[model samples]
Structures are given as C-alpha cells and as structure tokens.
Target chain A: MSGGKPLSRFHQPIEVPGRRLLHHIHLNFVKKKVVGGGGRSMNQEIPLIPFIDFLLCIVLFLLASFSASGELPIDKNVKLPNAMNAIEMMEAPIVAVTATQILVDGIPAGSTRAIIDSNTKQKIEELSEILKNKRELWKQLKPNEPFPGNVILQVDRKVPALVVKSVFQTAAFAGYPAVSFMVGRLAKE
Target chain B: MAGIDTGGGHGGKRSSNHEIPLIPFIDFLLCLVMFLLVTAVWSHMARIEADAKVPGPPREDEQDKIEPEKELHVHAKERKFQLVWKEGSTVVEESEVERVSVNVGDDVTFPELAKKIGKQWTDHGSHRAAADKKFDRAILHTDNNTEFGVVIAVLDAVYTPQREFLVGNKTEEVPAFHVTFAAK
Candidate 1:
C-alpha cells in the first residue's frame, strides 16, 4: 500500500492524458537477473512446503476414500438389508433377487412370481441348471482342490423370505450349498 | 511434485537456459485428483455366510450317536424370536423342548440368549470334557411369513459376542454357536 498507487474507481471509460495503466506492470514483473544485491536469489526460490502439504493432503484423502477390496457390481434394483456383525464380502458368483425377478450373474434366471406361486419342488429349474454349469466350470478351473460352495445372494430388503428360500434351495440343489447374504453395514450406537 | 525451475542454481548463480512449465504439471495432478475424488464411494456392503443344507432322509448311523446335554433351535417368527432347546435327554428323540420368546427390538434379549446358550454348553458335564472347544451347531428356522431383515438380525445376534474381554494386549470375544438354517 505504501509503494503502490491507490486503486482507481471506474465510473465510465475515461482517457487519461499523461499516465498509462499497464506501463508499470512490466517493470514490476520482468527482471533480467534472478540474484539480488546480497547474492541470495530470494524471489527465484519457490517455497515448496505448501505445495508438498497440499499434495500430501490429496494423497491421504484419496487413500482414505479408496476401497481396497474389489466391489461387487451393485444392482440398483436390489437394496440389501442392514446387519450389525457383517463381514467384508469377497468375489463370488452372485444370485440377485429383485422384487420382480431373480437374476444369476445379472442374467434373468426366473420370475419372482413363478418361484413364489409354484410349489417348492418346481422352484426355478433354470437357476439350478445355471448354477450347476457354473459349479462345473469352477471345478474344472481347480481340479485338485475341493470346490468351495460359496454363493452370494443379493436380495432386495423388501423381498420376502419365501423368494430368498426358493433361491437358496435351488442353489443348494445345484451343488452350491453355502449361501452368503450380502448386507449393508449398520452403524453401532 | 511441482516446482518452479529457476535458471539460477543455488548461491545466486545465474543461468537463463532452464525453465520448466508448471501449468501442464498442475493440470495432470488436478486431473488425477478429480478422477480419484469422483470414483470414491464409501461402500457398506458386507456378507454373512450360512450353510443352507437340504434336509435329506435320516441315516442309519445317526441313531447311535447320543445327543449332548442340549441342542439349540432358533425359530424366527414375524415379530418374535422363539428359542427352543432340550435339557436332559441323552438322545435327541427323548429330549424335552424348552421354549423362550423375545421381541424383535429387545436389546438385552440377544445378549441374554447368548449367555443362556453359552451356559448350556459350559454347564454340561460331558461337553466341557471334550477336546474340541466348539459347541454343537444350532439350526435356525425362519417362518415363510417373516422378513429377511429379522432373520439377519437373529443371525447377527447369534454370531456377535455378548461381551468383549481384554486379554493381554488385545480384546477377544468368543463365538457362542455355529448355526445352520433349516432348508426351504
């Protein structure tokens, strides 16, 4: 404020007679030599601490926000129920049950009405066939090892137990006996 | 890391040959930061594994195996949890069924249930003497009319320990029972 001129007020465009507006800017900014009289280039050295701090903050924020585990492709139609003691989910074959239909790996295996209306024995034969094929493929992939009968069930929170049970029975009959229910984590009070 | 390359090295040495552009460097960092920020979502999905074994015909060898002091059963109704178990019969066929009911939202009921089941395993004279520390597996049956949330709540109650104990430098909570669901 002491060395510089006061800011000019703009009412309308007025031509100045003797003084120029942009003449002082080049003199203030452009310089031929970086070294000062004391042989220390104070203006040339950029303080990198602030920049480092900013970079560190961004890195930490990205790290904290990043989910290390691979996420299961979430089906927008199926809203999972919340559970208190739920554990981290792993990659597996998924069986999603929406309000209207049943899906195997995102493919429509059968209708929810068909499973709920029909008797337990007639519950979705198509789902069992798909599951059996998946099990066979998994077995072939790992010949010496025993098959881990893990199946992930992503059912809508509003879906009834009847539909869930039908899916389970079909999966079990198809050789995937272990069923894991996918749920949202309920916060502790 | 972005830096302003000054042609002047240290100690006031002057050179005009070196000048690094910072605009493109900052542009790349901003792009990376924006990409990461946009993709970041706090996912809360977790899993609870259950063995949905289909009940088959009775095997001939099962008749000889004597039942432990008690066998656990959890009957999940629409709005209540009915826990039934047998006390004194050597074989499951002769055991008496003792039933207890707790409403869905009772906070202490699940802890109390865990305590009851844990005591049943510990108080039994023979079960304590066995080499394996694990208790007998329990069967969970949810009625067709019940919602899946209630069943999950029951599973959480069964799996999570009632109390956490500070042992040495770490805290530990022992599981009460290994549970399986009744087939559809």
Candidate 2:
C-alpha cells in the first residue's frame, strides 16, 4: 500500500498504526486534511447560500401574510349615520353601540333596556349607580386620568336619536368626555 | 504534499465547520403569521347627520329657500298638546290634540297610553292619513315635565306589534296592521 503512492489530488488514504482496524480510517484522514488546510476553501466551508435563500423566502412570506392579516379598515354591517362635518379617525379604539346594547372593545358595556329604563326619568338612582360603577372601572384601568380611552361609538342607524343622546349623556357621566362617533366613508361605486 | 498530509489528519476535530439548519426558523415565522391571521378583527364606526332651521319667510331673491318637504310641529303644553303641520307656505293642519289625562297622583304606565293612542290613531283613520292632503307630517312635542318614559311608551305603542290576525281563515298569525313611526 505504501508503494502505490497517492495519485489523486482529491482524496488520499492514510495508514496509522493504532487505527488500522478502523474501516474509514484512510478516508477520515483525507477528509481531515482537505477540511483543515487554511480552513476557508469552498468545499470545506458551510454552504450559506441555501440558508440565505430560505431566509429571504421566509421574510417575503411573512411580509405578505402579515399585511394580508392586519386589522380590517371597516366593517359593512354598521350603517353609520352621515355628517357633513365629520372627520376620519384612523387610530382610535372602537366602541360599538347597536340598537340594543353598548359594546366596549367588543364586550357589552351596558344594556339598552337599562338606558331606556333610565330615560323613563323614574330611575335616576339606578342610572347613577351604573354610572358610578363604570367610573370605578375606568379609574382602575387609568389612574388619575379623566377618560378610559379614545372611545369610538358606533350607533346603529335605526336607533332613535334620543336613545343615542341618552347614551352619550351616560358616557359623559361615566367620565368619558372625549368620545367620538364612528362613521364610514362613502363607497366609490 | 507534506503539508497536505499533516493537515488532513487534524481537520476532523474542528467544531467551526458545523452549521445549524434553518428549517426551524421558517416554521416559527409561519406559526406567528397563522396566529395573527386568526386573531385579527375588522369593524367600522358610526355617526349622525341632521340639518337645523329657524322659522322664517323667504324674500323674492330667496324664493329657492323654500324646501319642498313638509314640517310638522307638535308641542305638549300644560294639560294639552298642539300639532302644526306645514307644507310649503300654507299650514295644512293646526289643532289642539287631546291626550288621556290621569288624576293628580296616579301611576300611568306607558303601555296603557300606548294602547289608548293606538286605538285613537287607528279609529281616526291614521293608516290612510298619508294618502290625504289634510296632513303632511305629525310632530310630537312634549314639555320638560312630561315623563320621558311616557314619550318612549307612546312611540313604542305606535310602532310595536299589538296582536296578530289570521288571513284567509288559515289560522296563521300575522302582526296587526298598526301605526308606524315612519309616518311622523
């Protein structure tokens, strides 16, 4: 085996006294030499091109998917009343007011039955109790602040104007004065 | 050849040549995107719009100020109510409309008033009031002393379904033909 001198530049078998019985001892020696020399050759280095390609693909996929899944600009079921002087609020938190209930951040804030009952003008004490509870909750969330958040009220079109007014009054009594009504932009078509 | 021979024997022990596969990172971002897509909610806001006007007559140059739509003015005074229906420059109807009066200390529920109003409007042929030129609009104005509940009850009575009547003797129930708030 020693007389057969190494012919190829790619791989050469090695003979070590202690590891002669090892099945891949010769190939292991050649692999070590090829990988160790200067340590910067293309064959010896890790292939980062596929990894970079994979990363770029992942980045593009995430960007596309994130944009597609972002919060929706508008909902169609809410038929907002029109106002000649209403301005758009792009970043405000949403509060919905259907014909029968008030929803704060999609959770029911108060019942329409309660509001109507209070509007009967016989339940001022009950109305005051509800207002006080709302105030306490708001204070806990935002200590020393006058309001809970930028409230966007979405009242249904079919609700009476008086009912809407009473809701606003109740909200104001609850210490939320910076409330704004929500409205949709007219569709182009 | 001697350097290559010496280097080949020692290269296998280097840990710097190892690299981590990237399949796991791709999996993470995919999971994140899925989570965001599933949790997002999309809804819109609502607002109101109306016009306000003061009573006045238009001059010759302001002839176009006359809006074609009729305006009905109803005011609830002490123990009585007034209804003024206007169409253009002419007053189509003006009269003192009567309401059921309760004693000084009686608890009158809205449902009772609603029934009374419903019966009166039905008997007075309010269903056909829209077809007649005698009235354009019916305005209901109430005093501050008037209980808001009474107003809502009156409105509810006028708008709510009272009873169901069957058609063609089939015994199928349908809402009674009643007064609609749309008329006012």
Decoy 2 TM-score against native: 0.36
How does each model score on lDDT? Answer: 0.66, 0.45
DockQ of each: 0.46, 0.07
In model 1, what are the clashing residue pairs, if there are any?
A: none
Q: Check candidate 2 and list the clashing pairs.
A: A33-B8, A182-B45, A182-B46, B74-B141
| lDDT score, candidate 2, position A104 | 57
TM-score to native of every candidate shown: 0.66, 0.36
**Candidate 1 lDDT, tens digit per residue, A2-62?**
3333446654454444434444445443332232323445555565557756866896789
- Candidate 2: list runs displaced more than 4 Å: A1-96, A102-131, A140-150, A187-189, B1-16, B38-184
Question: What lDDT tens digits, residue by residue, belong to model 2 across residues B1-184?
Answer: 0012323336566543333445565577567656655654443433321111222345567765546545444454665555454566687666664565432222222334445444544443232322232322334455433443344334333332233333454432222222112111
User: Candidate 2 on A1-189: residue-level lDDT in tens?
Assistant: 354445565575653234222334467656555555444544444565575566667556656556453553333444454322234454444556565666655655666556565554222233335555656776797887755334455665555545555554555444444456654432211
lDDT of 2 at A24: 41
lDDT of 2 at B58: 54
lDDT of 1 by residue, B81-134 (tens): 555664544433222223343443422224454444555545432333223454
